[model samples]
Target: MKYDDFMGEVQHRLELPDTGRAVRATRAVLQSLGERLQAGEAEDLAASLPMEVDYYLESADSGQRFDYDEFVGKVADRANVDRSDAAYYAKAVFGLVSELVSAGEIEQVRAQLPDDYEDLFALIDAEEVEE
Candidate 1:
């Protein structure tokens, strides 16, 4: 997706008031996800995202170990939202990302994450995941 399209969709999905908030939320989720994934895996996922957001993922330190609770903590801190809102926003972002990337890529991501992260994809009705 193009940068505008990606930001607009993220703003709409998260019901954020403005572009800046959407940017923060998107970065929070992608950066936290990047920290969880290994370098190559994070790169593979970032390859399909818009350049603006891809940097958030690709730039993370990578391979930082943390559970879902800590993941929520990280996102909450980065986005300046409560833990519940962090999970909600993160889920919406992941849903959108799923639409943009291939199913194999999504599967690879899911495979790397433990079952604790499954709920984060609950919003993903990825009809477009084939590509």
Candidate 2:
């Protein structure tokens, strides 16, 4: 997806008031997700994303072995939102990412995370099931 489309999708998904909030959610979720993935896997995933958001994954300190709760906490802190909103933001962002990224890369990312992180991809899975 292009940068504008990516940002617009994020804004629509999160129902945010403006581009600024969408940027925050995208940065927070992508950065937090990147940290959880290995450097190579993160880079591979980053390769498929838009220019504006890809660096969030490319520049993360990968191999940080935080669980899903900590993952949500980090996103909440980074996005300056509550934990609940952070989780929602993550689901929304990941849902969009699943479309832009290839299936093999998605499997790589899924393999890196534990089952608890499945909630993050709730929308992705649901859409797949319907199709």
Candidate 3:
């Protein structure tokens, strides 16, 4: 979902009065994020993005995993921000595109243990070796 929509839904869920000032605040936050992302400042992004999502999510539902669409709708409604903005924010947070790419190193060394690996301990036969 767009950033505006996400903020709007969050605002709505939180029961914040939807007003012009609230909408402006949402836009300003999103615009600032865009600027940061454009600068390729990844560390800063990692630190801030999740915190924002967590704050909004917690404030809205007090620790619940609402559907992406539902959260977006509520935020959009509350913040009076455009749905497009909410969509943008959702894409950034939930799209998983960035994670998939950045986490390539971890994907490279991937391995799956055989189910029989657990049997190795039983097969050690320590008693037989001593005898």
Best TM-score among the predictions, by candidate number: 2
Model 3 scores a C-alpha lDDT of 0.37
Model 1 ranges with Cα > 4 A deviation: 125-131
For model 3, the stretches where C-alpha displacement exceeds 4 angstroms are 1-60, 93-131
- The global C-alpha lDDT for each of the candidates, from Candidate 1 onward, is 0.91, 0.93, 0.37
True-structure Cα RMSD, model 1: 2.6
Error of 2 at 115 (Å): 1.3
Report the C-alpha lDDT of model 1 over 1-131, residue by residue, as the tens digit.
89889999999998999999999999999999999999999999999999988999999999998988899899999999999999998899989998899889999999899999888777664443643
- Please list all clashing residue pairs in model 2, or write none if there are none: none
lDDT (tens digit, per residue) of candidate 3 on 21-65: 444444433333332222223332233344443233223222233
Q: Compared with the true structure, what per-residue lDDT tens digits does model 2 show for residues 1-131?
A: 79988999999989999999999999999999999999999899989898878999989999999999999999999999999999999999988898988887888899989999999889988988999
Separately for all candidates shown, the number of backbone clashes (residues 3 or more apart, or on different chains) is 0, 0, 23
> Could you give the candidate ranking by lDDT, starting with the highest?
2, 1, 3
Tell me how far the alpha carbon of residue 17 in candidate 2 is from the true structure, in angstroms, after superposition: 0.5
- The alpha-carbon deviation from the true structure for residue 124 of candidate 2, after best TM-score superposition, in angstroms, is 0.9
lDDT of residue 69 for candidate 1: 88
